[model samples]
Target: MLPVFTTPPPLGSGDEIAVVAPSRPIEESKLQRACDRLRETFSLDPVIFETATKDWEWLRDNPEARAEDIMRAFEDPAVRGVVAVTGGDDQLRVLKHLDPDRLTSSPTRFYGFSDNDNLRLFLWKHGIVSYGAVLHPTVTVDPELHPYTERYLRRAFFEESLGVVEPSPEWADEWFDFETGDPREWRENDGRTWRGEETVTGRVWGGCFSIVKWHLQTERYLPDPGDLDGAVLALETSEDVPLPREVRYTLRAMGERGLLGRFSGVVVGRPQTHSPGLEWNPGDDYREQLRDEICAALDEYNPDATAVFDVEFGHCSPIAPLPLGAKVTLDPTVRRIRFQ
Candidate 1:
């Protein structure tokens, strides 16, 4: 097993946080609102890069520029944390330009999800901790940040462990229209319930499924048995909402790479709401097929490890913040996930 490492302390009040756009560009207005909310609500001073608000013409206008912003954020001692504006599909193109030494030496709170999975695992491989959770635009635009999201963000970025993560009292649907600026209505759906009351604690790792699968093809964040040993594997799919066979193939590939059996447990997020082109109805059996594929993969690979499902951590509303590389304990009996 790769030796475990410690993360730096959370950003206290009055610390500076840098906001950057590492992948696709974003809408300037929404980005500014996100920054403004952070300052007004949390008293955090933010530093934003130029490209963060500008939508690059391509995957990224310049991968080197993205790398520079990240490096600068890490190198700046005043910057206590870093948050991505949003995530996009192609971040692997920028991996080669990053300076791992800077990321390793200055450990800041790195927050993002979806395609940011590419960067999160990169940080993890270098012994730095990053977070897999809501980013600025997604969480900031909420009429009010979801209580669970705010609660966990506070714990992950400021305070210590507040307590366990329970299923969101209310959840959201696939129809949230970002352009309208209205808070998305909460929609609860049925799925698997927490199985048992046993808390399985271990190091936390893993990220978005499609992105992780993409990373596997490159050296930037390929899974290593040594790095994954004893870590808790966490995953969620993206908006693409891949089919069951695709999901199975991806997990099966991980198993082939010897990554499936190395973790202490598995935490799977709820499947995303709007999958492109697949107009699956609310009560369709697509999710059931997904569950079956996942179970098959797990049983084929690591049947002994503890596993749980129906976690509200994906391209869903009212998401929970998860600190990557931190310690997480899953209690199926009580339906709680505690990060310590």
Candidate 2:
């Protein structure tokens, strides 16, 4: 059995939430709007750092500074949670500078996805609970944010148990054209449907597959021998929408490392359809290929593992906010996910 760790304390309406650029540099204007939305819509204070809006030499150019911001958030008695403005390509660079001892003791509610997977997995290893979910502008800042997205974030941060993880009726990969300063584009989004039935329950973990593969190669965010046993592993590809083979290869590596068998169940997020160079058909064929590849890998490691694919979460609209270390009860009987 995995040694369950501590769950971070919840946030209150008037409490402050820290915003930091742990991975990539977000546009100043975009960051401002996201902060504004958080305050106006959510009614929570959005605290930002000096470099929160700047793009310097690298996304994580100032590793020490980035680490400092995280430590500060965890140490601050007033700050209820910490959120990453956006995800960049290389966040593993910031891992070495982090004070794990400080994080292990603090257990602040942290949120981010994509490359932020580096930080999420790091927190998991140190016995601190973190969130693997959408960020500010990615899922929040828009003409109108997804109702369920806002609700999930609110409950994940402030409420005791994230009551029920429901299938988002609507989902999307559309980016709110923030260059216009107008929030009119927010309503554009794809919708979600309930996929295969039969929910399974376990602790939640995992994130962007690319980032997790990167961390595994670097041996940075590995869980202790028994830290992840019986956990419900959740994963999603980034905007890149990697080929089915690439996904299989990554999972194959996990099996080779003996990590794939640690999970009691698995939750696969619906892949994003749009990308810069590649275009994938949002059809049943593509979905079938994806399912075949992922299942092939899992079957090789743990054939009896409970798996659910195409869950409405990840780098998209109407995404689900998952607490990295939270216990998740996936009841397929009702197609529900309850976090306790």
Q: Compared with the true structure, what per-residue lDDT tens digits does model 1 show for residues 1-340?
A: 4545657668888789888888876677667777776787677888886657566774365888888888888889899988888888778877888988887777777878887777888787777777765355455656776677777677767865535777777766555456776877676656445433446787777778877777776654664667777778887777777777788888898888788888778888877655547665424665677777887887888776677776767576667766677788887666667877
Runs of candidate 2 with Cα error greater than 4 angstroms are: 1-4, 139-141, 179-200, 279-284
Q: Which candidate number maximizes TM-score?
A: 1
Using lDDT as the measure, the top candidate is 2
Per-residue error at 27 for model 2, in Å? 1.2
lDDT of 2 by residue, 25-91 (tens): 7667667778777788778898886557557574445887888788888888888898998887888
TM-score for model 2?
0.89
By summed lDDT, the worst window of 10 consecutive residues in model 2 runs over 185-194
Q: What is the C-alpha lDDT of each candidate?
A: 0.73, 0.74
Using all chains and alpha carbons, the TM-scores for the candidates as numbered come to 0.91, 0.89
